[model samples]
Target: MEHIVELVGRALLAFLIMMVIARLLGKQTIAQMTYHDFVAAITLGALTANLAFNVQMKIGHMITVLLTFTVIAYLLMILALKNRSLRKWISGQPTMIIQNGKILEGNMRKLKLSLDTLNQELRERNIYNIEEVQFAVLELNGEISILRKPEYLPVTRKDLKLKAGRQWFPIELIMDGKIIQDNLRQNNLTIEWLMSQVQKKGLTIAQVNYAVKSSNGQVYFDRYDDQMPNPIDKE
Candidate 1:
């Protein structure tokens, strides 16, 4: 009754506060989140979450706290954008995890990334072998950006003296144990051919991890293996 009403009121105020503060923080602040940004997000969530359970805190009190944080966060964001020194201080420069096909043991130790963790991230970026990486940077946002050895990179038109056209995304023909008939039709492929191809690989549609159609009239497939070959033969 009365307790429920009070709880509802506090919840509404907390919601309003969060909405206003999030609006003040620009989209990029939320989008390209760095380590500090993640901390701030957690802090804000905890602050609001407590408001609902803590009867001692009033709606106005929560709003004031929210306003204080919003101003500080917004001012710091502006300063970071306008002042290069502040930006560098607030968001530390990207740390080179690997360079020249060699892992920086000191940097890895400093970042607290174990060899196994580093290897996992590399694999996610389609880089299985660390020796193959020319550069591996641990971004401030905790994302690993990789640059592979020149030999491993795609052969550009300049490299082979071949003409290039617009690069296009591949369409998924089957996903999650279901036939994507629309995609098959769009790519001018048939279910019978698809089944035949899968059977050739000793696989069924259930075993396929991905099926994508490239603009070059090629269909690619991947098994459950993340390390599977690219543009897997549909034949």
Candidate 2:
């Protein structure tokens, strides 16, 4: 029982320490994590696990090591942000694997990427044929970025000589029956105005599952009960 209690306590402490270190390292999505970031993450996880499970190891020494790794990782992040040359040296640069509808075999070989893998990545991007790609870059994070040929690209409103109106992101005023007062203030809306809009849809604030104000000054509401008949023909 005593051993179990010590293990639990250690685990909690390690978790809190890891959380603090992660926050200090800043935020980067999995897709955005470069080679150095990946190494640091793995090292941190191993250290944290050891700290949690290895009871014989001195907790203070392990914590000091963890903090040292975090500091180094944070410093590297700062250097990467300020120094372009150092960033390229540490994280590497994006390599062009495809150019002008042709696969660069030499670059692909240098990156240790197989032609099959390249095709698979291209297929994931919805380009089955390499001929459709004007340019393709292998990002440092191992994701492929593709630029489709002009003829293969989707036609936009600009290409059709059509005028496009200004667009705005929708602001959530109410989510899951909870009022978002900050969103209301941001959009210069009031609780009274929101209640009125909810009433217009035959719903009270409590009945609303989601409520958003669109950029075009339109209030869109969805209720908890979605039993309303379809307005459009299914056929």
Candidate 3:
């Protein structure tokens, strides 16, 4: 039990020390991390994490290791600041993943970035189609930056020279076959009125998955299972 407690205590200390070092390094150390920064962060974290639980590694040894690495990192960063070429080498240059709506196959190969990985990243950024992108850059720390074509970008009210701030909000009328009285009262709607609207869509309160009132004064309706039978029934 004492051994376990010691292990936990050492782990906590290691985490705290690393956290302080990271905070001192500033947000740019991770936010706009270069390849070297990324590698350094990971390697340091792994080393500390292992040292925390490894009984063979004393706390003094861990501190010594951390201090040594921190000094080295500080020196490297200072040198990098002084020398542009060193900075470029340490950080690496951003590779063009896509240019002019086409993938740079050579860059992709060099970076070992696969089509699937690119698509996944794009999807996370709400980009559905690759052709919609004008430029895609792979940063040194492996993050992607996308620039979409004008046509692919969502149209803002400013584009049409319109001052429209009164955006529409949807009101929840029902959820999971239960009448949301609070929402109904908030929207100045009644259960009877909601039932009448549901009937218009050939649906019942029991059959509705969600019923919502749109800002355009439209009542949007959804069935519990629109395309197929309820999966809950299968279970």
Candidate 4:
């Protein structure tokens, strides 16, 4: 019983320490975490696990080790931010893998990236044909950034000298038979207006599984029942 109590107490202490350390480190998404950050995370996790279950180990000594690592990581982050050279050394730099529709074999070889992987990355970005890509850069985070030839780019309204109105995202007016009054008020819409739109579609608030009001004052709805024919089939 004493061993179990010690285990639980140590686990709780480790959890608190981890939370405090993480808060000090600030926010970093999985994709944004640098190589150093990744290593620190893994090391801290290992130490915390050992602290939790390793009764033979001293709790105070384990905490000191964990805090030491956290302090070092935090200091490194500060130094990297202040020193550009250190930043580059820590995270590396983006490598140009493709230039002028031609692959840079030397760069690819240095990065240990295969031709098949390059082709797969291109296809993921919807550029199956290498001729369409003017430049492709492999970022330090393992993401590929592509630049297409000017001629292959999509034509925009400004390119055709056509005036386009400002675009707005659709607002959810109702969800799961509940009226979103907050959204309606923010968008300057009324319950009566929403009711009319639902009636036009031969639906009630309860019947509507989801509903959104488009920027152009159009209300789209999905009914709870699947009795309606598929719009794809109609098309």
On TM-score, the candidate that comes out on top is: 2
Worst 10 residues of 4 by lDDT: 226-235
Q: After best superposition, candidate 1 residue 231: deviation in angstroms? A: 25
What are the models' TM-scores? 0.67, 0.91, 0.62, 0.71
The candidate with the higher TM-score, 2 or 3, is: 2
Q: After superposition, how far is residue 197 of candidate 2 from its true place, in Å?
A: 1.9
Number of backbone clashes in candidate 1: 0
150 in model 1: Cα distance from truth in Å?
0.4
Q: Write down the lDDT of every candidate, Cα atoms only.
A: 0.81, 0.88, 0.84, 0.88
Candidate 3: segments with Cα more than 4 A from true spot: 163-235
Which ranges in model 1 have alpha carbons more than 4 Å from their true place? 157-162, 165-235
Query: How far is 227's C-alpha from truth in model 1 (Å)?
Result: 33
Residue-level lDDT of model 1, residues 124-143, one tens digit each, is: 98888778899999987778
What's model 3's lDDT at 166?
63
The residue pairs that clash in candidate 3, if any, are none
1-235, model 4: which lDDT tens digit per residue? 9989999999999899999989888786245677678778899999999999899999989999999999988988887789999988865678999999889999999999999999999899888888999999998778889999998999999999999887678999889879999999998989999999999988888899899977875788988886867545653
Candidate 2 at 39: error in angstroms? Answer: 0.8
Error of 2 at 129 (Å): 2.4
Q: In candidate 1, where is summed lDDT lowest over 10 consecutive residues?
A: 223-232
